[model samples]
Target: MKAIVITSPGGPEVLQLQDVEDPSIRDDEVLIQVAATALNRADVGQRLGSYPPPKGASPYPGLECSGTILAVGSSVHRWKPGDQVCALLSGGGYAEKVAVPEGQVLPVPEGVSLRDAGALPEVVCTVWSTVFMMSRLSPGESFLIHGGSSGIGTFAIQIAKHLGVRVFVTAGNEEKLAACKNLGADVCINYKTEDFVARIKEETGGKGGSTLMMLSSQLASVWYDISVWCFDAGVDVILDNVGGPYLQRNLDSLNIGGRLFLIGFVGGAVTEVNLAPLLIKRLTVQAAGLRSRSPENKAEIVKEVEKHVWPAIAAGKVKPVIYKSLPLSEAAEGHRLMESSIHIGKILLIP
Candidate 1:
């Protein structure tokens, strides 16, 4: 099998496609012949040496993939050889073959292509777990997501809108903002030129609602400012993907009894956080990472996603937004596109 290996990670140029031994499966895992995989910011962070794969995970960088089952371990009963599936992976999705825990595998949605299914697992699980499960965003609530044109942002917008939430998004430019609007974002703020806090306040009439989702890498620099705005607007639940400097602001942004779910540390891993807001507001801050979770935990999230989100995709109420597809050998190019932040949705690597 061939896989993308980060050789002394530095830049996209460091990713090398090389032949490697195929992975073997555990009793509860399945071996998949990957059809496609999707690029994510985590991959870029890994490539640049900022993020490392969890202990015992594959050295390869892919986090989600779609493929056919080649074999199943003795305890795997939900699927069989030849079954079409997509999986949320801890790593090794960049290869032609990977062994995945049965719990993380999902049957491809009825109407979606096998290749496109690769794009769904990561974004869907991320959004459903953070926004719906953790944040408890309900119908008629106002929801705001940064980087509205991103894979997670795009999916979050559609899912929130489908559930009757009014959606607001911040994008870098008019084109991305327009794309977000077409995906049901009620208010689109051009973060590069305009003030998102002001626009969000204006759009929600000074009450920003309960749930806020942050997906932008720029969150570290502006999280404090955003937090002050959230404080004024009464934000109660925040799903944050950018960590470091944003931790304190995340606490400050929440109303009394607010909950903050931290999922990623794209900006930086270390920062100083004020403890006053936490004690004064009685806020709860929890951190989660899918790639490092136990199989049982991942299975729970996959089960919820399959039960709740797959139906939406099958019914056309929500769909995977793919920006480009390249051959598996072009994994470096995929990383480049992801880092450039010019693409509007997921970028797939066909294997």
Candidate 2:
């Protein structure tokens, strides 16, 4: 199998196309003839020699893919050869074939294109597992999603909206904000120009503000007002993908009894945290990784997507936000695009 390999830590140029051994199928795994794979921020980090794959995961960089089952393990009962599926991979999705646990695979929803299924698994799994399952985001609750133009952000906005949750998003530009609007983002804040905290308060007439809080410290000055605004408005829950240095602000932005769910530290990892706020406000702080979840837990996420997310796709109320598609040979370019942060959605590589 020909796949992209990161030869050393450096720029996109570090990624080289080479032939590698085909993955052997395990009794609990299925072999997929990959039709497509999608780029992720972690891929770039991996190429830069920063983030290493978890133990026993694929050394390849892709995190999600759409493909056909070529062979199923003897114990794989739910699917067989020739079934079209999208899967969440721990890694190694950038190849012609990758072995996946049967439980991580999902049938392409009705009316969804197989190639576009490349956009589904990672975003759906990440959002559903973090925002809905772990955070307990409910209907009518004010939900603020960062990176609104991102693949995960777009999916989060659509899924929350379909479930009757009030949705807010922060993007880098007006164009990205417009895209969020098309996907039913009630409030779209351009972090490049607008103050999301203040704008969120104004949009919800301060009601949503009181129930949602800011979660990034990279923009402490910018988010300081958010801290004040959300505190004044009384925030209930917050989803923090950028952690580390911002932990203090996340605490400051919360209302009494608010929940802060930390999923990633795209900003920086090390931080000094103060416990006084956590003690006084009775805040619940949680950190998790969906990729490390058990097969049963992953299957539950797949089931949730089937029940809650697929219907929206079938009804055309929400569509996967795809930015571009490149050939498998151009995997480095895919990583380059993701690193540039110019795109507002998923970037797929067709095999």
- In order, the Cα lDDT scores of the candidates are 0.83, 0.81
Q: Can you write out model 1's per-residue Cα lDDT over 1-351, one digit (the tens) per residue?
A: 999989887989888999999999999999999999999888887888877998989999999999999999999888999999999999999999999999999999989999999999988998888888887888877666767899999999999989998877778889999999999988887867975655655554555443443333355466432222224443555666678866765565455676777777766779987565665567778777777888888899999999998888889999899999999889888888888899999999998
- Candidate 2: Cα lDDT at 137: 81
lDDT of predicted model 2: 0.81
Return the top candidate by lDDT: 1
- TM-score quality measure for candidate 2: 0.88
Segments of candidate 1 deviating more than 4 angstroms: 207-232, 244-258, 269-283
Q: lDDT tens string, model 2, 1-351?
A: 988888889999888889999999999899999998888877877888878887888898898899899999989999999999999988998888999999889898788899999888988888887777777888877777778888888888888888888777778878888999988988777776875556655664554334344445446456432332224543456676778865776665555676778878998889887666675567788888876677788888888877877888889877888999999888878877887888988999998
Clashes of each: 0, 6
The candidate 2 region of ten consecutive residues with least summed lDDT is 225-234
